[model samples]
Target: METGIYLIVTIVNKGWGDTVLEASMKAGAEGGTILLGRGVGIHEKQTILGISIEPEKEVVLSVTYPDKKDAILQEIVRAAELKKPGAGIAFVVPIAQVAGVVHLFHQGSQSNSEETK
Candidate 1:
């Protein structure tokens, strides 16, 4: 298990995934993963022609060391304007174990990546 590693999950409007990724990277994260999702938030409800609309969302996951967590999250919030209503949310969770991302701990090691294949 890897201690001191955190996973920052940021969910924002569809087109902002790239912004979150860029922000996290600028704040010292190596990279992040973006996933497509759909849901309607209380402040994001919409309708057109008497039909309901479910907003599309982008789920961004950034894994980083403890030291980089705060900076990355701050940048994400600032870049995404998360403080405003319907701007989306960001949170962090501790990671118990990690694999296939050896580069974060070992600059040149590829063992974990190779073993997976």
Candidate 2:
């Protein structure tokens, strides 16, 4: 168990789940998890008789090396088309501890470096 692992938070369009996964993998993520959610923002509303509307979303979580996290996040952003409206957002968090994967962490770091080259 160690602190300093990187976690990527990617929120994308509802139907872009597969695209996010492919992008993260291509950018050096071993794997990822997805969760369904709803987006709430200033522009996330409709004016139908003063009614409000919010769009559904998909949140993709990829935990990787501190080094690879950036590239993985970038890939998700690009692939998910987050630059467009309603595409969602992405970020990274530093993990304080993890278990059952000491060796894998080392391997992930090595692979991350290699991929960046």
Query: Cα miss at 9, model 1 (Å)?
Result: 0.4
lDDT (0 to 1) per candidate: 0.89, 0.77
- What is residue 54's positional error in candidate 1, in angstroms? 1.0
Off by over 4 Å in 2: 47-49, 100-103, 106-117
- Residue range 33-94, candidate 2, lDDT tens digits: 88998867555666567776667888888888778888888888898888888678889888
Clashing pairs in 2: none
Output the lDDT of residue 76, model 1: 98
- Residue pairs with clashing backbones, model 1: none
Give per-model TM-scores: 0.85, 0.77
Q: What shift in Å separates residue 93 of candidate 2 from its native position after superposition?
A: 0.4
Tell me the spans in candidate 1 whose CA falls farther than 4 Å from its real position: 107-117
Q: Number of the top candidate by lDDT?
A: 1
Error of 1 at 40 (Å): 1.4
Candidate 2 TM-score over all chains jointly? 0.77
